[model samples]
Target: MTTLGNMKVHEITRDYGIDGLSITERNIPSLSARQVLVRLDAVSLNYRDLLIIKGIGRWRPPAGRVPLSDGVGTIVETGSEVQQLTLNDRVAGLFFPNWKEGAVTTEKTHDPLGGPTRDGVLQEYVMFEEDQVVKVPSYLTPAEAATLPCAALTAWNALIEKGKIHPGKTVLIQGTGGVALFAAQFSLISGAQVILLSSSDEKLERARELGISQLINYKKTVNWEKAVLDMTGGKGVDHIVEIVGGNNVDRSISALAPNGLISQIGVIDGLKGEIEISKLMPKEGMVQGVQVGSREMFLRMNQAITLTQLHPVVHKIYPLSAIKEALTELEQGNHYGKICISAERNQ
Candidate 1:
């Protein structure tokens, strides 16, 4: 919050990967009119963060870019022109700050937070317009709130906002990652039945504690679609959160009920794959691509979280100095929830 003092930020250098990361001190930037200074308290890692860190494909940021897409912070200093926000208000930045409402566009999707074009929250302080950030639920801690910007909102947009997932609907979620678990939780909240798929039995058991009764081990039962069809009495599922892309989508299509919706959220398997249109046509299956949501959607999600007292599942929290370890843990794909970075001076 003090422009007079030097602040430490983790930067991406030419080397790339964990070795490429360097922490250096620079002058804390001054805020302009309409921009409020935020002291970021926490950061959460996403699969996309791993891609950015590894310098994969289009995810490769320019040299000296700061990486991370999700964070929760407090307004340490408010600009003179800023309104509707007071000092000490806790908030999370929107992944797509320009996509404030309704319908997406090329312009709205540009300059995403913590992506190649913009600096992220790994630093001690962030600056944004009051409109670019939304107040988090009062009951949620910084780490829990940190997970909302990307993973939580993506799941919400996929299930609640677009799919209208509720009672009488059966949702099949793939994996035990942040978005998948959040989708399972939201599905349960809306009175929908969930069938979750994971390679690990341990993760499946953990999901059971979240009230998910139907679990499938994709590793053991390779043809899990048949299991889904059998469970639904040959009716298939009403929704599928397609986290595993490539050929796995075809399998999801095989397990869809008539008019079922599949929210395409990830590409862990492969980026490009062909879909068998004949299968989808018979079921009228809809595959909707989901992006992290807007400010309006984030606010609505915060309200629902407040009402339900829902907590984001955090697998682990590492000190800011231990970010490389956090990223490595996320890369290993062993964690069941969001991985976070503590921004405390001593952490």
Candidate 2:
């Protein structure tokens, strides 16, 4: 392996049926044409990274590499033909390095930051293409900016791109994780009413303080879909950010108004379950799959964030050496925002 100065990485790796990744060292990756070497400032954890570490679903990367989907870093070196990035530029890599446009799909979304596809940024240094990096907002810290690529972009894509959630529209966000919180904020910023659902009443109370119009404690209100209907005067919400797939889809579909949209993003509870298509037929509603957004969509989302002065909620951060613990905390789902990792400390 070729060394580009000094480099070390703390990443999650899984082989075969084994789980719980470990850290390892390798020669620093060299930059290719139109690529840049990035010195990682911080890396945020997404549920996708957790899925990859657990070797679940379709997120598995290639064999023998660090695992992660998104990270923020400063450009240290650039390839000869790379005109888009420069040294010291504050930027975050995209969810799909090669995906530049259009709706994301299985073939296009095959390669992500961490997992088996490519090396993740949980390490001290990583290499990326010029286009794969999106500039961070001046107001946000690297840790905060790091959360944008996967979770925020997914929410943005779900609302702005697919659901077209607009002013006067009503949107329902499930849970308190990065995506749901962003959905709530985006809805508020777009002049729409937001209903946040959570198992924890305490977190729901905090969301209320943030101006969330309504909070549904799903644990207390198991049939929360009916509550949504009541809140909307029996019209149902215009859009629902569906994080819990499987059995929950039926409820989400039931909560949609006429021509309503359901941005299907996750399956935290479990993916294997049935949905009643007839529930959607009468309303003529739509259930769209939301992968993270494109680079162009990311730029648009950045502009929206800037215009609204929106900030990503960061619950806690850990040093790079404590990646495992950070991941454990994320899996426990107690945080109201994102879990981050500081890369430089692992050296």
lDDT of 2 by residue, 214-257 (tens): 88999999899999999999999999999998889899998999
Cα lDDT, all candidates: 0.91, 0.83
Error of 2 at 213 (Å): 2.8
Clash pairs, candidate 2, are 61-116, 61-117, 62-116, 62-117, 67-114, 67-115, 68-114
What is the Cα-based lDDT of residue 153 in candidate 2? 94
TM-score of each: 0.98, 0.94
In angstroms, give how far residue 158 of model 2 lies from its true place: 0.5
Question: Which stretches in model 1 have alpha-carbon errors above 4 Å?
Answer: 1-4
Candidate 1, residues 215-310: lDDT per residue as tens digits? Answer: 999999999999999999999999999999988999999999999999999999889878888999988889999988888898999888899999
Compared with the true structure, the alpha-carbon lDDT of candidate 1 equals 0.91
- Residue 283 error for model 2, in Å? 0.4
Candidate 2 lDDT score at position 74: 86
